[model samples]
Target: MSEDYQLVGSGLTVCEHDAPVEGPVVWLDSPSAVLEFVAAGDVSEKIVLARGGTTTFLTPALTAGVKGVMTLQGAPESHLGILSREYGIPCLMSVAFERGVKSSRGETIPPDGAILRLDVSTHPEGRVFIANGNGHLDVAEPAEVDAEAAAQAEQLRALMASYRGELPKGSAGDRQIRARLRTGVVSTSDENVRRDLAGGEVSDYLSYAGWNLWDLIAARQTEGESGLIPRQEYETVAFVQQWSTYARWYARIVEAIGVDGVIELGSLPRREIGTKVNHVHVWATLCPLFGRAIATELGLEDASARPEDLDALIQFGRRLQHGLWGGGPGFVASRGYAAPVLEASWLERFRDEERRLDDPDELSAFRRFNATTELCGFLLHYDCRAGLCDTGPYPLPDGGFLLVRDHFLHEPGYEWASVIDDLPHCVTEAMFFRPDEDVSIAINDIATTFAQPANYLKHLSGAVVYARDRWDTPVSEVRRLDEAEMARIAHRCDEAMLGLYQRIGDQSVDERIADGVKVYTRDMMMPYARAAGVWDEMVAAGFDELSDLARDAYPALTGGAAQQVLGAVFLMGQGLVPAEGLPPAPEVGPEALPVLHEIAIKGSCPDVDGDAEALEAAGLVVATAAGLMLTEAGHARHDELLAAQRESVDLGRLAAAYERFLAVNGPMKSLSARAGSAGEDERFDLVGQAAELVERVEPALRRTADVLPRFAGYLPRLQEAIRRVEEDDWSYLTSPSVDSVHTVWMECHEDYLQTLGRSREAEGSY
Candidate 1:
């Protein structure tokens, strides 16, 4: 099974998996123990959690204040779902089977890389395909539910039915889901998860079900974060590497600065003036993560001291960071309800994007629950550390215990210490005052709407698709009750599609939106193979709209026409299904390619006369710049693919083309239309650097990093990096740079042409 399936997708990671654990076998009944278990891993393992009955405290962990130590019992956060799943742990919900899960001597697989090993306690040769696959990632094998363990499973299911929250009627479809669980068939019900899906553990309530939510969020927190700007986790980490020389400079900024008086000294973390004097907002956003780091290093008492005490600040400078980037914001309590499962970046959610986008007219669960984004204060005391909570007696700088702030609406209501000349140092402690009730639905609705669904992806059709399936069934990967349930499932997918459209529409031309669209378009295009023949037909379809191309000269369109005439080929050959009459994937006559070109032409370049002429006239290639990063990412990818074929690409030719790309980009560079900040230009340089880096590192990458050995996670980041190359988003590909991912992909394709010793048009790069 491992040989056949490689689970590839984004968020790939490498963790130092040898971290210590309390022990392997755990009692699911103990909530505190479960919290400890979930708390154990950071970039590596999530406790191999499984359960059948009575996970009472798990709900609380999910609901615990976003800022504190809490965990979920039934499921850790959704992100951990992939970890538990990919690592081969089975979760069953009934004591009859659940209690009988382990032997004192069972083995556990480490959650590093893409490999997973299954260990059987009593039954060694049981099926291991339950959780393996690119699609259907959430399916779990119930040893009891199998024909071999049906009796035990039934007893367990019956017991689970009797134990907790009674199953709701008209809630969702679960039968089709259950049917597939026993067998390997996936119906439409298996696909989506949205709000309609009745059973998402609210982002906050996991603690109630008895798991530690804090450790879960902590694991979610990404390090190497600098300042309060919202940047993608991967981007920020890479960005910080570029800024490594300024560690102490920023640290000094922290030392000399106070929450008041805003004259922005640096261009890096920019400040706006007037009604937009949003500096206060930036400072507060940074406070949470900085506070956590300080508290972790020096006890909270020293950290809580006002800016003047200099003790915590002193503690800060001594911490030898591996690079300039370190902490930024803290646990941002999201309103990520069941709208569509959204992933909270351990970084971005806490950055000041919230204050920037904040509209006074809008209603939000965050504001409803409390007036601001910070949440630990509401969940954890009037002085939470005082008599209420049991964790510590950590000392303060002023010879007193640090107290929790009672009001989440503002910082601790303490006096500010005058740094230069105060007699006594002042300290401000944080507190949370969440009432003893459930705040899940309110919070989730707000955050979910704003969140980029599934870790930085906005309006992810994939998540919505998955959510609808879960919505149809309370438990995952089970079938729908019937056909009507299936219709509802499809409707939900459409609805989610609409929601995504609304979100995407909001960012019609934004870079995150544009890049995400291309990312999605490419992913969505995957199921349908992109043969060159397909492109020619697309152009023909849109041919009449393109004034530059005369229709008859091309005659009927060919797949190449689709490529030449239209920039994109969307839904081409969709008619193949009905026209596919008999046997072997239907040979749609030679005429098919031309039709595809027409369709593509109609779809993409119907009126490129505007942007194309305007930009080309300006000696700038906006379209080309738009695609550089994506293209370069592609170039690296094709090179990897070519190497795997025992046909190494010509590095010298690629380097030559890269140089050409640079020459054409001058004058032709569309400096005005580029995506990011003035600094983003520098960041874009990172893409160009990556292109050059891939060229430089190709030999090593081929030797050490090429692991076509796994599927899915393998080479998926290349998906982004690939598009960067293909699109010539680097500005090199558009005008003169021979180095383009499209050029690279094509050149690498030409290398394959060389390998096969076949003549291909790509050989002569015009």
Candidate 2:
């Protein structure tokens, strides 16, 4: 990296819109944004003022005199890449720009530094120029661009100007949200779109409301709108996102109130008769994961009794992320999962029962989660006004995943017809809030909340029976450990899990050893099972690959009732099912860079209909079996999807992917030169080769944006798991390895990236 790079500027500035309040400056985090910037019709050939260090592609902009009329806003290393490879330009981030801008106009640079003189090559039409390595900048000569491109860029710039005003201040975020909300012509400069893509209250509401509403809006405008992410769909993601908005706020409220902030909810003004509720309802109906003794003691149900009872409930609340909302095994007789029908002969009734609601497996949990999420939505609406949910997406970094299955999750909304279960609104409303104000608790609060000794004894009762198939240890022996170390281990494991869960739920969970175990148990083994199953099933026709792990896992554990205990452990692990298969990228091959990028664009998964073929046909490459099969027309469908998005991105994800692409291609001088020739465009030429370069990367870029964060997000969690394994605590591991968050998050994300044009072959790793 050099200390000095200079840009010489003529007196000129060009962009379709009025100047941004701070004076518009380019901040390139992604190559896609670079492409978009050139395609925006905002650059002028007359000015060549470089503001920062140079980078590979940006050099020509300076050399062609489009460089540094104003300011450049990136780093020196990045700037240098754009410099020596092309012509030099002055950029503001440069020390020279600062000294020059601060000093007078007629300043001369010291002879020791690299200095560029200014020149002009203006076009009659208002077209911006960007370069391609093919001796043509992405910017085209005036005649090469089309009217539609110019008009669309203008339209987007207008929208961008408006987006800039939406943010009251600072960055606006709420998961994979802003991208979903983007609609209509996109601003050429993703920076411009980013400047405008902020929302305060409206975004807050939509965060809870779900992307479904956006889909709903678009659905109304379109013909075939059946496939959309329903806000109320029966999926864990919807459930998580629903409360995330509140969780974000609740975290703030806690900071504002205290660790005991939830208690204040009980004292709030009673809701009007018709007002929608928060989670208080579901909190009421669901059995506490811990049990009644604790719930009653916490002023949860207004019960007064013994010290044991008080200790029990407190333990339950403290143990689970959701405490005793649903009673544990003790209540299982009448409060937990089987509570609704334990003695009612529901299981027996299944033998002869006709097809009906409550099939036990499908709708139950899914229904419960969505019902609660929607309730949380209404509750959050009140909280925002009432002074509870305050911090933005709560801003904590604790992240995880949830599952979404079509036949299982989809259901009619409250406003739609329901052919599904006819459960009363009371049960549905139960999702509002669990018993105590502590929403950060877990459903696994099965320790103190169960009927205590009684529930423990009962669960063991069946344990004795199932132990008959064990690997030599008597059921009585394993059950002995339950009594001997049950509560003690329960306490230790409780502390660890609770610590992990709270951090994760609040998104404030540290990426430390404690959370690492969570990632491993949750991410690795689980995902291993998932990917194994999918790979096996797809590779063969048998779904039996899952059976081996199921068998091997229990026998491997030490204990008599080990199977039963393991089953329970598995259930606890079940909550993070979708994330089970996450694994870091396999291995990508460097020489296969273009193919890798194409694979990343067009998914490697058979289920995907990504941009592989399309990007290839559009001058990219597809080096995978799945990609080669897609027709050019099929690829166009991929283009249509990307073009239809209505949101803005920092383009950081795309940059990472492209950077990965660059790394693979860095050595291939031939391809790099070819890439240089056609990739960068100068003037806004929507239909010509210049436009084609932008077009080739846009969908791939969007896909890069869509999936990478999900991948990037898993790193801290993964590192934490590595730390945990080193500690060797036999406690339940929730991390991505062996079974952790990072594992699945990585796999799922990598899988998506592979579908895009980025292939593993090019990167030299999967």
Candidate topping lDDT:
2
lDDT by residue (tens digit), candidate 1, 486-545: 234323322332232233223322333223222222211111112112323332443113
lDDT at residue 606 of model 1 (Cα atoms): 29
Which digits, one per residue and each the tens of the lDDT, describe model 2 over residues 1-766? Answer: 1223223222222211222111123433233334445555645433332322322223223322353433332322231321221122232222222122121223322121123332222211121222111121121112346789889657544432322112110011111122223321111122221222332322222221222112112212111111111111111111222211222222333344443332323212121111111222212111121122122222223322233322322222222212222222211111221112111231222222222223443223323232222222222121111101101011112231111110011111211112212211111111111111212211111111111111111111011000011112232332212222323332332233222222323332122212222221222112122212332232243321222222232222222333223222122221111122211112222333333333334344343334333333232233343424333433454444433321243355655665553442333333223432342251122113322332343444355546544334333443454345335421212232243322333353454443444556676644
Q: For model 1, what is the error of residue 370's alpha carbon versus the real structure, in angstroms, after optimal superposition?
A: 14
The predictions' CA RMSDs to the true structure, in order, are 30.8, 32.8
Q: Stretches of candidate 2 above 4 Å error?
A: 1-175, 178-212, 215-596, 600-766
How far off is residue 94 in model 2, in Å?
A: 61
User: lDDT for every model?
Assistant: 0.23, 0.26
